[model samples]
Target: MNALLSKIFCAQRVLKNTPPQGEIPDDETLLRRTFRVAWPSTLESFLVALVGMVDTIMVSRLGAYAIAAVGLTTQPKFICLAVFMSLNIAVSALVARRKGEGDREGANRVLAQSMVLTVMFAIVITAIAILFAEPILRLTGSNAETHESAAAYFRIISAGMIFNVMSMVINAAQRGAGNTKIAMRTNLVSNGVNIVFNYLLIEGHFGFPRLGVAGAAVATVIGTMVALAMSVLSVAHPEGFLYLQFQKKRFRLERSTLATIANIGSSSLAEQLFLRFGFLTYAMIVARLGTTAFAAHQVGMNVITISFAFGDGLSVASVALVGQSLGEKRGDLARIYLSFCQRVGLFCSLTLAVVYSVVSRDVFRLFSSEEEILVYGEMIMRMVALIVIMQVAQVISSGCLRGAGDTKYVAIVSLVSVACIRPLAGYVFTYPLGMGLFGAWIGLVLDQFMRLILTSIRVRSGKWLNIRI
Candidate 1:
């Protein structure tokens, strides 16, 4: 196992070198650097996803109603987080560019400005989520029984949005400064804390009160607070790569910096909102298929999300490397990093696909005992295996584009492929044709293929090279 792992890590050493711009590293050196930034990020993402799986498994014991309720909240929660998450993309890109230019003060200023915006947005989202949680759940097609627990979970989690968004943006800024390990460590510790609290609170172990679904929300909020503290400390450390001395004087907004981040982030915000809207529509279609099918769909999605962690990890590396390379005015180097990231992402996806295909049944058995759910989930897992192959390419390529400040085109593609095509196809397949849950997945797979083709075209065209942050 160790030998196989070593070989995988060393695989990039063999890629033919791109023609050098002055002082560009050789292939081996560059690959090693990329690995250093990527592996920790990847492992961190995997661990976080794994914790989510554990959370689902723990809650599954409460009944399918609990699972479905939680599942229903996923897209709505993402919609709330979308704006801050989008801004993090801009924070990362600007930080990477400034770091590459060797302007430490500029990078620090960007981080400071982002922190200000992060707090403001989090407050607004928290208020809306708390005040309208029930309505929001109902809008997503949650039935009465599910709506009650979903509302509880949403309100508590929403109350902690400030901490969660702060932690996320700070970590993103760290990644932009080529310090992925700090973010990785912070996330790992936070997840560890979450799991422990989940065990105690959810089941009332160790004499803790059994708050059930609300317990999960409380645990998550506490975990996020811990992470936020860690993130702030990392950034405040004197020797840290992106240290900022937080002071009243430094907290004032600079209009130009705000404009720059907004310019880059607006498209990302639109993309996320559109994608979330499409997901809600897709979920509603599945929900209409009845509770059993929707529960199975949710279980299958939890399993599939693990594979996404692999692509997400590589995407993080792609964003950092491509942004820094562009900052250095080395478009050729950015291309090389993107190619390397895509290859690594492909390998990870294919390996995950094989594992998922072989163990589909056993995996579903962990989530539910119902024969119908297990059977439907197994079939969905097979589709997920195929989707991962195409999805990885699209994800990594989009990250590369974001790093280049070319978010508008990525947003347009998502609006067309995911927002328009996916749910529309899912509705047609699920109802008019009566294909059921399997039919819905087929629509999702088609969406991935469309995105893959479009993103691949954009990356190859080199139009992103002209984008200015």
Candidate 2:
């Protein structure tokens, strides 16, 4: 038990307290302090990834074709999420700043506007995704057999965009205000619900009719709906940090607040779109490679996504802390927060990479048993582990940039890294050199290295603070 606890907290940041009234801690303290805040977040990511893995497994059983289909579908979903999720981060940054400066009303105003924006964008994105699901699936290199399966699955899951957006927005808001436990609990219960529903609905266990791929869709939707309810209850509860008593007057968003969100968040939305776009391209390339490679990439990607949750949670916390410090006009505090997060991220990526390297086969087995797909998944997983150090640097530095209202620069960097660098590298590696799946993995690894070096330099140079967003 003690060993497990140590593994969890090893080299993690400990920004569990509200930032001090006046002074930022010293560099040594910043370097050495256990990242306590990151611990819950890392565990929270584990639970979320577990659900994702289960979702992949439930779909994988139908066959690699289904796995490929869903995997292809998820590429766009990440971008879709990036769009709406940026607004959530915008809200979090704004609210954290206000809260840091001791202005509750300011924070509440940001939350109120965030809710309105989240719903409006959700409706717009959902319509486009649902209406164009078939074409998008076609573009993903599907045959007739795969397209029909993917379309049904995507359309069903896409139906719940509003719910997913709401949960994400509110959760970001809560986390920014230093209330992460609630979001953690919300995900835990929500993932459990998703797992149970997937088991019963997919296999037709206990009187449920077999729904196959569509059943996985249904389970995800139900999970989102339940999570949405919990988030609403949290917002309604007076004690919650982000609970908003939405007044008709407050609904008229002040231009200043609206501008703050848009100025920063537009970059985030764009960054997400491009990032996902690049991922979609990667998916397309994998599809072009062949169905087996595509399926392995899908399952392997899911496992990687689970590992990614750790970096993401830490990044989110970094954003809150860094943004709050900047809001308080304490650049020193921001620096401390940024440094601590980078160190913790490095530690996490290294540890998780080691684990991925050791238990990769078992991890791959959770998704598929087909010799071809399993081999592909294991190779990608190991490759990802090798690149873990670079991944850590990129995630932390990106988060630091985002927290400083430097969303535009971050967006630009993402485009260069994922869109230009990764896909281009993948093409070069695969087509010219004939590296295949290993080549694709190499592309990703190199892209990550470029981002880590560039973003770290950007953070250390302090140019991000000059951005007006």
Candidate 3:
């Protein structure tokens, strides 16, 4: 059993810390506190993806064409999310710092500004997607048969961007406040509603006609609205640590605040853009290998996505913890927090890696009955698991750097690894050597390896310790 499990879940170790006299909490206390914040957010993220998985299951009944259509349409969804997540990156860091410094007013200002930007982006993105929906679908490599449904789905989902942005922005604030339960509770409510709506609308159940492609988009919209409502209510509740009150006079954007947010936000946005583009590039390559391979890739990638969602949660906690420690003028505390988070992430990622290498075939088989797809998917995913497990250090360390307001450098490093090196490696490996599918997957590993080195060096050098605001 041990050998069977070694393919994933290999990293295992407790977080360590040493409390100062009447100053820092003891190691056990610190770890527990961080875990309390991280666990729910992590679980929430995992569950968030589960809801999507369920949506996929429900939509699959429409047939394989529908499944493929949904899968293809989701690419643009990722791109849009990548764009908006940038602002959340800045919002989380800024709000965390403000809360740590006991500046609720400042945090509120940041939240308000984030909302404004999100609203503006929503208007622009939705208009663009709606006006040129067909072109966008074509750009994503969709065939004519799938184009109509994909375009329609994209159009409607674009309308929901406002609510999606609102929910994300609010959670960014709440997560940065070191209060994740609010976000988790809101997600639970929204996801529950989403499942019911998807079931009812997709199948035309309970007197509702089956809406097909449009139904999925409508379900997503309803979920976003519900999630937004929960977010607004949560923030408004007296006991909630984070809430937004419209400011009559605080509407103007401060240059310093804009500069900080833009600096961090743009950096984060750039990294995700590059990362997603890399994945999209790899997907294109896989698409050439055969439809079967591409479909298998899609199924296997979801597992990786599920795993990374937890990593995202852990990294977010690292940001909040490190930012708060810095706000308290405790650089040493921040460093300690950084180390502890790094250790925890490393352990969790490695553990999952072991699990994948061993039981990945069984896991992959759960999603597909076709032996060929399962076999290839198991092989490919095992490759991903190998790198992803050790790469948690890089993710958490990058989060630590961003938390300390070193966003620009982090962006630079990420661009080099993700943007330049990754695509270049993939191209060379694919075209010149004829390595094809395997080459593309291996290229991803190399990109992550380089990122691991860059992030580790940045964290160790302590230059991020000097950044303020």
- Sorted on lDDT, best first, the list reads 1, 2, 3
Q: Model 3: runs farther than 4 Å from truth?
A: 1-22, 238-240
Which structure is stronger by lDDT: 1 or 2?
1
Model 2 stretches astray by more than 4 angstroms? 1-36, 466-469
lDDT of each: 0.87, 0.78, 0.76
Segments of candidate 1 deviating more than 4 angstroms: 1-19
TM-scores, in order shown?
Answer: 0.96, 0.91, 0.90
Candidate 2: worst-modelled 10 consecutive residues by lDDT: 9-18
Instruction: Give the CA lDDT, 0 to 100, for residue 208 in model 1.
Output: 96
lDDT by residue for model 2 (88-196), tens:
7688777777777877778888888888888888888889889998988888788766888789888887889889888988887887787777788888888899999
Question: Model 3, range 422-467, lDDT digits (tens) per residue?
Answer: 7778767867889866676677788888988898888878899788
lDDT of 3: 0.76
Best by lDDT: 1
So what's the TM-score on candidate 3? 0.90
Give the winner by TM-score: 1
Q: When superposed on Cα atoms, how far off is each prediction in RMSD?
A: 2.4, 4.1, 4.3
lDDT of 3 at 307: 71
